[model samples]
Target: MSNWVEGQVKEIKWWTDSLFSLILNADVEPFTAGQFTKLALQVDDKRIARAYSYVNAPSDPNLEFYLINVAEGLLSPQLAKLKAGDTLMIERHATGFFTVDELPASEQLLLLSTGTAIGPYLSMLVQGDVWQKYQHVHLVHGVRCNADLSYQDKIKQLQAVYPQLIYTPVVSRESANLGLNGRVTEVIKNNRLFDLMPHCVTPSNTQFMICGNPQMVKDTTALLLDRGFTRHRRREPGNITVEQYW
Candidate 1:
């Protein structure tokens, strides 16, 4: 039996020159929200594959993945060139421990992501379990520029339906009217990030899920550690849970 199954591209949504969402139709096994699966393409008889977090909820009929075209990337540049009806190989099963189910009980859930790393949080948010599980949900997306912030409409819709969901968009490069204007770590360090939120962010009341570029994840986790938060583990059960989006 083959582990890879064929997936037909249904649509390509370009949010910016470098960022896009690839929507496909494939018969993949049920995946939990916030998990990721691999997508592959055959190049010169050698298969190249990369892992992408699912942007769509498990109930959604189609599979959606948000990605940025790395200028010199082996697979992403080719992925960006794909058009409707093109076929690619998708891993039959998804895997990751980023799901909300893995977190311990807490009053607040802080989901922090940078760039396309926001995809998994979008999945968890749309799936509707986060709202019921946490009293307050803070979704912070940090992007280099205003244009990098995608899915505003979807985030707004989710906010409308779930008042408990609070979104904060941090733009590091330029000014943005929507949310705070600084890097996520900088804002948090200066207490500006906490000022925007309605609830307090103590380790006892909040559980942090940090995902994004390796640097952002490392810095954020370090800051949280400085504030007395510890890395979450199955046996130890601490405060911070992280997934590095390479």
Candidate 2:
């Protein structure tokens, strides 16, 4: 067998206009819900590696990941061309710090994501840990329009049963009766991020997870810090956990 075996592409699903999910039959031990894995593509005699966050539950035998097709990415160009039978290299090890396992227990889990950065959050939710820990799980996703609101059916179904899980879609421009009509930072500045929790994200019993654009990550991190939320790190532990993928 090849040391780096080819993972079989099993399933493909589109969440939104720009997001797509692919399932691969990766041969490896189970990874944590919020870890990332690298994908390799053959170029001449060398292999190119690109890291991607997991978007599936670890209990599942096969590996799955969500991706946003960026027109300029060299690897994404070939990754998008894959089909059910097609093959792509899957890394044996999965790693990342952006998981619910790192942060301390809290009453509220504020998952603020943008674009394709919502991958890990979705994985966390699908794994059932989101509702397991927090009394209230609030997901504030920022996108361009309703068409960008991926996982609508799945998110809504979760909200229907678990009223504790709330989803607020923030659209910057296109808003045809979708959700909030502005950028997520503007919403946070207006105290919208705390509307889900009665007491807000205080150091007492709230935690934050932010992903997406660099500006958004920076602005939201500063805003949370001003509100008494500290960054969660391996050394200096705080209430906020962030993974900047911009």
Candidate 3:
């Protein structure tokens, strides 16, 4: 009864110099839409692993993981070199509490993410459950530059299918002609972010799911708290939910 299973690399999609997505074929157990699983590789007779959220829907035949090749990292560098047909180790069961089912009832659902942290939200979006649960769903992805905005076609496809799905891309380094040209927290603080949304954000109507780098998550949580939002818990249901990537 081993916990690890073999996953064959089906494809590798390179979006940028540091960003990539691994499409793998593995017989993983049924996972919730927003859950994450660990991938491992043997390095110097030792096993190196890292947790990565699934980008594909749970029902999809292929298991997909979005990742960034961290410079001077241990596991990611090896993972980045993997090719189609190569085998890797994947945990048999996915785990995480970041699914939509964990949220409290709200009219609006805001999914804010940065970099590769957008993987889980993409999972939830494509799974088709969020659209039915919330009247309006906002997906805000904050990136350093326009080139870091990966999965545009997939997001556009979901937008077409679900008209209520609002996507706001925040490019901080340079001007984003189509999107906001500031950090997500800055835009929200200055009231520029909500300008693109269909309705105003209130603690009563909005449930925030913020996932990204630790700094972005921390700052975003603090900003929301300042606006009267509280951290969500099963015993004490509140507005903001968060998951930090690295």
Stretches of candidate 1 off by over 4 Å are: none
Model 2: per-residue Cα lDDT over 94-154, one tens digit each:
8887888787877888899998888788888888876767898888889887788777787
Better of 2 and 3 by lDDT: 3
Model 3, range 1-246, lDDT digits (tens) per residue? 898999999999999999999999998899999999999999999999999999999999899999999889999989999999999999999998999999988899989999999999999999988876799998999999999999999999999999989899999999895679889899989988877777888888899999999999999999999999999999999999999787
Q: Model 2 reaches what TM-score against the true structure? A: 0.91
How should the candidates be ordered by lDDT, best one leading? 1, 3, 2
Residue-by-residue lDDT tens digits, candidate 1, 113-204: 99999999999999988876798898999998888889999999999999888899999889986788889899889988877667788888
Best-fitting candidate, scored by lDDT:
1
The whole-model lDDT of each prediction reads 0.93, 0.80, 0.92
Worst 10 residues of 2 by lDDT: 192-201
lDDT for position 141 in model 1:
96
